[model samples]
Target: MKKFLQKYSEFMRGRYGVDDLFYFLMISTLILGLFPNFLLKNGLGLIRWLLFGFGIFRYLSKNFTARSKENAWFMKVFRPVKKEIKFLYTRIRNIKTYRYRRCPKCHQQLRLPVRKGKHTVVCPSCRHEFEVNIRF
Candidate 1:
């Protein structure tokens, strides 16, 4: 077991091995695999296999620089979507206690306590004061 582990580590020494893009490909492949055949035709199966193959290729590739660039590009493309999903989750979790609002001047998101009626709110980012009517 110890010899096998050492050999595996040596084999993977210069490989690109496991990254966000690899995980994304693997997870997408799994999700596609879970889809019913009736819902999605045979084309998705081909795509799933391709994704899985690509993910494995990435994991074992010796071209570290190329793999890093690909992962960087993937992250750049995915960052905004990830941020929005996190923001949505946070908003849902704090739905009862906080109300999320965007500051008009700076367009910054503000988390305000759940207070009913009209009130004056100040933007911490731009130091802009605005009146808000929270009728909940």
Candidate 2:
């Protein structure tokens, strides 16, 4: 086992092992795998296989510069979407404790404690006062 791993590491020395785009492709393939019946019925069964093949190609390719550029571009495009998903997940987890509201004056998002009633609120960014009603 040790000798095999050593040989494998040496073999992979100059190859692109993995990156963001590869992970994205692999995840997309897995998600598509969940609906095998739909994919086969639609004649799209090869889509996941193609994605997996491309991911493997990217992983084993010797072109480091191209792979790095593709990974960088993927990260640049995915960062905002990742952030929004994280924000939404956190908000859902803390739904009972906090409420998110946008300030009317500056349009800034504010996290306010959950309270029921009509109350006056102040926007910290623009220092604008407004009334907010929390029903739940």
Candidate 3:
């Protein structure tokens, strides 16, 4: 057992290893694999195999610069979406205590306390001002 574990660790050295995109692909593959349609199931099964193979290929890849650049590009695309999802989750969780609005100019999310009147809200990001009517 120890020898196999050591061998595995040695094989993994200098590899790209796992990252967020990997987990997303894996979870998506799992969910799609459970579809009721036979064709969908088969397609997802093929996709699952491909995703796994891709993951292993990445893990064993020696081109560190290319792998890192690919991961960086994926993150550059994925971060804003991930942030918005997290912001929405927190906003929904605190729905009673706060109000969420978007900046008209830049569409940045603005959070404010629950109040019973109209107020001018300034976006910290772009310094855009907008009127918001806060009412339950």
Cα RMSD, each candidate:
2.3, 1.5, 3.4
Cα lDDT tens digits, model 2, 1-136, are 9999999999999999987899899999999999999999999999899999999999999999999998999899999999999999989999999988999989999999999999899998899999999999
What is the C-alpha lDDT profile of model 1 across 1-136, one tens digit per residue? 9999999999999898999999999999888867859436655567778889999999999999999999999999999999999999999999999999999999999999999988899998899999888888
**TM-score per model over all chains:** 0.82, 0.90, 0.71
lDDT for every model?
0.91, 0.94, 0.81
Error of 2 at 1 (Å): 1.1
Whichever of 2 and 3 has more TM-score, that candidate is: 2
RMSD, candidate 2, Å: 1.5
Judging by TM-score against the true structure, name the best candidate.
Answer: 2
Position 63, candidate 2: lDDT: 95
Minimum summed lDDT over a 10-residue window in model 1 is located at 36-45
* Reference-based lDDT, residue 66, model 1: 96
